[model samples]
Target: MEYLVLALKGGCMGVADIIPGVSGGTMAFITGIYDQLIDAVRSFDFEFIKKLFKLDLIGAFEGPHLRFLLPLLFGLVLAMVSVANLMHYLLGTHPVEVWALFFGLIAASIIVVGRRIGEASVSNVLIGIAGAVFSYLLVGMIPVTTPDQLWFVFLCATISICAMILPGISGAFILLLLGKYEYITGALRNPADPGNAAILLAFVGGCIVGVSLFSRVLHYFLERHHSATVSLLTGFMAGAMRKVWPWKEVLDTVTIRGKVHVLSEANVLPPAYDSSFMLALALAGAGFSGVIFLEWLSSANRG
Candidate 1:
């Protein structure tokens, strides 16, 4: 039962991580495991390394705070692998509704995270605005090509992983912007291919280097300036809600390797003087309210 619960939560988080605008970190925050996850990552240390090199599994696991980490990671990994297929299916069939829920979730997250900033100081407000505008503009930019060189892969991994840990940004989306998403996701989907293997290996190497470095920075910020950091993250998330809005019109669909790829444009539904607009408004309202409910649950748990 315990394992099942963990797996279910992890699966939900994995689904969030797979999506372009959704954040696994946000899901972790909503679910009340964000701090624990950070602590586990922070526990990786020299003693843990020494035990691993010695092939002392028991010592290695115990030296780091593996008790918190192992189960959580088991959950996360299982969810990631499982949800990859599930998301592929859902996004194929119900893209709008799926995005709608995420849109609502992120909108709610902005409020939840924003309230954590105790004071609306001039600097903090400016910082918050800067964070929002920067992310908002950053999200709209086109993808850039990167040399598929191993060193570049390592750098990409470092940067992408940092974004992955942040509450608002999506690592996969970052890869998409970096022109590596297709390469990496392709590798995962077809590991037997040599090209795919190379891409996957490079990406994995990049993620390791990135995570190790960024974790320290994140740990410092969280410990020393929790409110300010959270406020900025909240602002980033608020701006990011633009990317997740549910209504999109399909611009084109292309068949690649016997699979369909959709290209879409954001659309606003016409405000009719009648019932369709009412229905959409209701759906949007329901979506927004659902997030508030989740926030309420989260606060209740914290209290």
Candidate 2:
């Protein structure tokens, strides 16, 4: 029953990860498993390797808290398998509603994370502002033509996976910046593509390397500089709002692998007081309310 519960939490994280502006780490934090998840991942270190060298396979696995990790990972994989296509469809067909929901989610996240930072120092505030500015600029950049080469594909995974584990940053959004979101998500959706198998394998490898290296750095900062780290992450969530803004004008489109992609988009305001516009506002409100509800639920659970 405990393992099942953990897997359920993992599934929730996976769903968050599937969305471009949402973070699996945020899901973990909301679900009250963020620290445990980080510790489990961080445990894959020299001690575990020593156990492996000593030929204590069970010890090696168990030493790294795999007992807690396996079920959670299984749940995450299950969710990605189940919901990838559904997310793709919604993003394609109901983009406004989807982006509106994401906008609300991020807006709420900024508030939540800011509160978590507790005290506001001048240095911390400045640091946070810097983070937000960096992310805002990063997300606003135009997607360029990227190479189809396997190595660059691997590098994309390496970079995005780092963001994926952070509380506010979205791995999928990072991949979008690198021009690999569609390709990777498409590969996951259609596993039979001959080239996809290799790409997916390489991606998995990159994830492992990326997560292993990056998790330790995050763990150190989180432990040693909790408030500053939280502030920076809060800023990141604030900056990411630009990517998920509900209204955008597509300046140009590019076809990649025979699929149309938005090559450039400029944010725009919706028409005033129209029915469609009102509906979008309602959806954004619902999304905002949803995050508040989650925060309440989390608090109640803690109590």
Candidate 3:
């Protein structure tokens, strides 16, 4: 039953990963599994490798927190594979409502994460502001044109995977900024092809390397600088609010692999008070309330 619940949380993270501005790490944080997640990643240490090298397969299997990670991974993969079409359709058809919900979600997340800092100090506040400024500038940067070479693709994965594990940073958005979102998604469509297979394999290798190294750094800071780390993360989510705002005036677009991609866009205010505005406001409220409910549920579980 516990594993089932963990998988359910993983599925939510998977769905979040499909959205451009949403982070799977945000889902994990909201679902109260963020600390466990970091630990799970850190569990793959020298002991596990030593067991593998000694051909003690069972020992290796037991070496890490596989029992916890396996179910979450299964659900994450299942949702990403299964719900991609449905999410794409919804984003295309009901863009406003969708973004509004996520905007509300992240807004609430900022509060939740902030509350954990207890009382704030001057240095922490400055750190938070700096983080917000960095993320705001980051999300607003224009996408650059880049090569389709294998090494560059590997580099993109290694870098973006770090962003993916961050609560406020969307790995997908990172890919977009790196000019590889379309390229990678296109390869996913025909993964059985030789070229696509190689690309996917390279991406997987990069992710493994990236996550192994990055998780340790994150764990060290989080364990030692809990309040400051969380404060910066809260600031990151707060700044990302600009990206998920429901209204946007698209400035430019380009076609890639026969698909139209938004190359530039600006967030805008809704034109007027009307039925559309009311619906968006209502959805935002619901999304906000959903997080509060999840927090309550998480507290109950802990109690």
Candidate 3 at residue 139, lDDT?
A: 89
**Considering summed lDDT, which 10 consecutive residues are worst modelled in model 1?**
262-271
For 72-131, candidate 2 gives per-residue lDDT tens digits of: 999998898789999999988988888887787778777777888877899899989998
**The candidate that achieves the highest lDDT relative to the unseen native structure:** 3
Q: Positional deviation of 51 in candidate 2, in angstroms?
A: 2.9
lDDT of 3: 0.85
lDDT tens digits, residue span 182-269, model 1: 6565566667788777766777778767776678788888889877788788877876776777666656656645755454445565
Report the CA-based lDDT of candidate 1 relative to the real structure: 0.71
User: What TM-score does model 1 achieve against the real structure?
Assistant: 0.82
Q: List the residue pairs that clash in candidate 1.
A: 158-210
Superposed Cα deviation of residue 235, candidate 2 (Å) = 0.1
The TM-scores, one per candidate, come to 0.82, 0.91, 0.94
User: In the order shown, what is each candidate's alpha-carbon RMSD?
Assistant: 3.6, 2.1, 1.7
Per-candidate clashes come to 1, 0, 0
Model 2 local distance difference test score: 0.84
